[model samples]
Target: MFRVSLLFLILGFTCLSCKSEDKNNVGTTEENIDALLQARYTKLLNYDVDSTAFPRSYSPEKKQIKQVPSKDWTSGFFAGNLWQIYKLTGDSRFKQRAKQWTAFLEKEKFNGRTHDMGFKVFCSFGNGLSVEDNQNFKDVIVKSAKTLSTRFNENIGSIRSWDFGKDRWQFPVIIDNMMNLELLFEATKISGDSSFHKIAVKHANTTLKNHFRPDGSTWHVLDYDTISGQVRGRVTHQGINDDSSWARGQGWAINGYTMAYRYTKDKKYLDRATATADYFIHHKNLPEDGIPYWDFSHPDIPNVSRDVSAGAIVASGLVELYKYTKNDTYLNYSKKVVNSLKTEHYILPKDLEVPFILDHSFGDWSKRHEMDEPIVYGDYYFLQTLLRLKEID
Candidate 1:
């Protein structure tokens, strides 16, 4: 029952009547997407949310909305999306809304329980800063990076990605952890602290050595012995199984290393991004529509639900990758995904359907399931992809 249903998408939507792509309006692609997202977000604003609770996901079938506190790893995405809308539309309403939601996450600068400060603080405050100069946002980002750095183990040459799995993992790091390095890289540029950059490079190097397979697919989790600096084991705790390529994990590498390459101008990171992107592009299980099954190695491929979130991540990353490489491959492929995702089956039919935009985002397919649901990160990445196209593509 893996799901991101086509039902809600096509059945009751206003935007479906809109053209999927206006080749003539290549100049207005951002405008079309922005209007649709703005309407989608208007519905979200009308929902009975606490504002601070942070809308995490919604199940259209159950008509339930899921919210989390600021500490949740996903806390920043909602605000980040708001910031992006403001950036794209230059609408003061979007800016004010972005600020309102992003303000709730300022306290997260002090949170050290996990290594997701980048997702929480950077995506929110970082995007806020991008909108306008804010000293407060700058301070929060620097301190959050410092807090994130606290988790880095010089012995292990990587940041510890988990806290609760103490018995199961001595020093665990996930491919998703590659994300925090982006924030750290930015921190160095702002603070002129090479220490932050060194930590980021070391962590990425450690991950490059351990997390990836020969075929360029990445393992979800890797545990290391800090003292020996040796990988204790590799496993896939959040995917279909230990041996499978989790869909989002692939998205992360494609997105993460693109950021790495952008910041460092490092060809190695670009090459790494290319490797993972190629694997994903050619994977046999990839649907013709450009979305992927929750796991590339799912036991039953076409039968499993697609993770539109993964498609969004890869699409967004490819747009950025296209800018760096000037390769039409990434641009053309990303545009195809944008066209595919525009269908009523993937995106919400209208603002009235749900507070969220896209559905069928899979957070996990193992225990503690988040299958075929709307996820905040999915909304963020998809909107982000649109914004990237607006700016540079």
Candidate 2:
């Protein structure tokens, strides 16, 4: 018999209390939702200690990984999310931690040399600390923005990725870079400079023209020759090769374009966001729990691993898309994914040992060690999606 007991338990824990309110009669009230989110936020914040500048992923159940530098980019991403929550709740504790995090990054000499510098510095220093008008942070953002702007090559019309062995090849621009373009845009806003905005627009246009496929899916990486400004190769960082679609890469494109639209108000960006989202939603390969296999084109299904992190990121992007279109379908889809994430497998409830909502996120396919780990990005986006929903309510 299909067990109804487990189903009842899931439903019982899934439905959070909905408080009565006059203004928002359709769903839960904003204040009530904020209170629930605040409780979760408090739990997450309490885990941080002076020994570490930011919250660790979790206390390991087994032997712990060696401690690295306190200023890693992954930790910075979570701090950025926490800063967003602080903005929503107006909590001083969140602000203090955020400040401490930025100070650590500033002192650490974070040069925008890696593809992840945008995710690292832009999210934390640019988005998080900028709101509070911290001069040190403002300078940090300006310096990073200048470094990123300098990375723009007029020949290829896209920012360079890394200083790999050889500089002859123009290298490739990956979809992940979209998250960093906001840094250039912000720089333009702060300095009244058009060059930064121009570079960002060109890069966006180049991605739109080359990176995306007709089916709305995108390549994980695209190599463009610097001298001639021509395409060289398209490859996947997480799949077998260029032909496969890594689910999270697609998620990044969807979320990136949605955010790009917010900055530029370009209808084309929205079109791309919706197109990428459509490809993800319409794909028949999703597991019964709503999470996708790590690679949609992975040869096997039942044997292939799933990435709940992809689901969490895409679910958050879907909510942002809904805000732009005000489409009920998008909102419903976002809610469905969130419900699955909270009830199906990964989410640890209030009484559970862990605080995160999703786990088993794969970071790289080359080495499978990252599989089944609680990725910081997954937790960040999950919190972001829930916070956005609260605002809508």
Candidate 3:
């Protein structure tokens, strides 16, 4: 009997040890990721890049880094990634590098030809402002918001999204515009301009009404009749079809509305965010690891590529939503995504000297461009998600 009791006690201690390791595993994973980022980004900073260009994506086959000009929508994400690393590690090396890269985007504040002012300016300058109170960053942000406000049409109660597709669309308003409202909302707080705030709210209200379906999924593009101020057609610019749910578009909806709720304290925005978040987290097609395919409605399920960018964006959004609601579901799923992304399947090889950290992100899946690659915005949001997780820990 005494021997039996000893064996049971030993088993109990082993179980406790297993539980302890499991509890500490998240921190260990995050530390590993931080070490990886330090090594990879150090190489990136050392690599010679043009003053006019920013790292955009990596081509593994060609072993080439894709660089784009400041006018590119993804131009700010690299700078934002550097700033995020600085925020995560308190490394002044990253902060200085971030400043240099961010400077390249200052001209984009005045370029209002496209609706990506928030993507081009806020991600770089806004992140810089969050790190340090630089007057120049504030000025850039306020001006960028003004430039973005030009795209907003009072008749449509929304912002026009693309300029190149004028022949295909009249007064096109994409669901992705929801992500741009942050710049406007922040402009109000910085410049004491209620005009910016009013425009953001109007855009949000119009998007909330027109973009989402009853199932919480959003159509990618809504073309409006300029004179009638009515949605002329619902279409998909990236998804498998007009009816399919593009994973990243859903992520944009979840993140954007949560941010809107943060600025406005409107429960409608909160409700919309929650609905979309729940739809994403509980979707039948979402992989067990918490990563999702390029489109949830893609018929080719397991055969499709996963979008680490979407996973990172949604993970960051879920962390924010968890803070607001204290919902364990949100926190747990965010943690799951972070854990999945830090693994070998999604993480870039350290020996691969690319500017990006994560891999297998789907960019423009319909055109088969940048498919299953390391995109700069993916790294940015992955880093952002890590920072968010660290804050609560």
Candidate 4:
């Protein structure tokens, strides 16, 4: 009897030991994942910066002494991504530099511009600066938001595009503008002004009516009839056209709508974001490396350049979608793209001179076609995605 009791006691202890071991293993796995994320987060915060306030893009090569004198909305997008990374990691350096960029945009030069104020200011100032609640930064954002709100046309119910030579396009709205609505929303929240929110919602609704296709692919540019208050034509300025999908433009829609859903909890925006994501994932043109070409329809173009920026941006949005839906598929897709980025082209292993992922990113087809260059937005999204993954794990 005593022997039987001893055997049963030993068996019970053995089972308990096995369970303990399993728990330990799981904890170790999670810890290792967190450590990996932390390392990558540190690397991203270390590199990626606006070399010059004048030109707000990534410059790994020290080619120009004077800050490259150009303005683009994509640079602002990258800065905004960096701000997000800082928010997750609590890294002070990221916050400081993000503030600096916001202050730079407060300049009279960049204030009321139209090409992609959402990418430029909303991401950088509206999202980036809002976390810290710095009064000066808030003031800068409010000013820019007011400027953007003024650009809204009552007739067309949308913001105008660039001030290119002629005022022919009175109410031209690009799909990219959908991302800018957050600035107006933030402005409304901070200033207690309802008009800002009204204008933002109107523009978002206008985009939903005209910018998206039946398949969820988005048009790059939409020209509106300011007098008639109607959409004139859907054209792709830097893309293939209204009929074709630009990979980056599609990415902007995915990220923009996901954000819209986050702020408003509107089911339509979430559905649109998912549909756009599905189009990107199932598209036949994805390269062997998992990064996509600049435009999905232009696959026949010889030596079609891959846009790492698109991959990074879409990956970040996918992770966000996963959070909302708890869909493992979205998480796995996001991981695959991020892993492809880390293993294949852009990611520097360690101890590299330049502080960016994916070398030779093309900014626009109009210039710098084949060259392997670093883009600011690529680095921004890459870092932002990494930080977000850390939070999830």
Query: 251 in model 1: Cα distance from truth in Å?
Result: 0.8
The CA lDDT of each predicted structure is 0.81, 0.68, 0.84, 0.65
What residue pairs clash in candidate 2, if any at all?
A: none
Off by over 4 Å in 4: 1-71, 74-91, 108-110, 127-131, 165-170, 348-355, 367-372
Give all TM-scores, in the order shown.
0.90, 0.82, 0.91, 0.78
Clashes in model 3: which pairs?
none
List, residue by residue over 78-115, the lDDT tens digit for candidate 3: 88988987787676877888899999899888898989
For model 3 the TM-score comes to 0.91
Worst lDDT 10-window in candidate 1: 7-16
Clashes of 3: 0
lDDT of 1 by residue, 120-215 (tens): 988999999988989888888899899999999998899999998789989999999998898898888888988889999999888888899999
- Stretches of candidate 1 exceeding 4 Å from the true structure: 1-37, 47-51, 351-353
lDDT of 1 at 117: 96
Ranking the candidates on TM-score from highest down gives 3, 1, 2, 4
> How would you encode candidate 4's per-residue C-alpha lDDT over 72-104 as one tens digit per residue?
555565456557756765667667766665555
Scored against the true structure, residue 300 in model 2 reaches a CA lDDT of 81
lDDT of 1 at 180: 89
Top-TM-score candidate index: 3
Model 2 TM-score relative to the real fold: 0.82
lDDT of candidate 2 over 258-318, digit per residue (tens): 9889889999999999999989977888776567888999888768878877887888888
